[model samples]
Target: MSLRCLIVDDSARFLEAARTLLERDGVPVVGVASSGAEALSRAAELVPDVVLVDLDLDGESGLDVAAELARCVSSVIILISTHSLEDFQELVAASPARGFVHKSALSARAIRGVLGENGTGSAP
Candidate 1:
């Protein structure tokens, strides 16, 4: 089954880029939110299979959203951020996130790997 995805980023350009990339790779992006508050609301409404979140949001941090998602939904939260791997690792270790992804190198393959998908090449 295709993995239902949600993108939470404050930048419109970044959001569009991510949406295009994921959709091209066959991942269904069900919802997009520009802020942590919006993410929280939409996440509950959509309950996507995976949530791709930006570390720096407009009003709140993605880490906060990750924690909230853990309590509010069953979706796996993957943090996509511009932060360095070391910083991302520290944040991920503290938060209840499934993984950390560098926005600069985000790809369908990498996403699939994080999700533990096999060689099917099909969306999880």
Candidate 2:
């Protein structure tokens, strides 16, 4: 089955662009939230298969949100950021996120790589 996704980010432009890009690449974006509160609420409602969360959600911490999601939901959480992975490697490793994805490298293939897919299936 295609992976259902929920994107949590503070930037409206990034959210839209990501939604468009992922959908174009065959990953169905189930929902989007601009804040941790909204993300939690939407996640509860959507029950997506995966969630791409911004490492920095404006004044909020995406790591905190990811942890909360991990505790409350069954979805795979991935942290996304414009910053370099090296900058947040330790923190990313400590967080509940499955992995980190650079915003510039965000794609179905990249996501599939994180999920350890061998490209034998359709979804990431």
TM-score against truth, every candidate: 0.90, 0.95
State the weakest 10-residue window (summed lDDT) of model 2.
115-124
Report every candidate's CA lDDT. 0.85, 0.93
Those runs of model 2 whose alpha carbons end farther than 4 Å from true positions after fitting are 121-124
Measured on C-alpha atoms, candidate 1 has an lDDT of 0.85
How do the residues 21-99 of candidate 1 rate in per-residue lDDT, one tens digit apiece? 9899788899999987788899999989989988889878889988988898888888988888796687687888878
Clashing pairs in 2: none
Misplaced by over 4 Å in model 1 are: 119-124
Candidate 1 RMSD to the real structure: 2.6
Write the residue-wise lDDT of candidate 2 on 1-124 in tens digits. Answer: 3579999999999999999999998899999999999999999999999999999999999999999999989999999999999999999999988899999999988888898876566543
Q: Considering only N, C-alpha and C atoms within 3 Å, which residue pairs clash in candidate 1?
A: 3-124
Per-residue error for 77 in candidate 2, Å, reads: 0.3
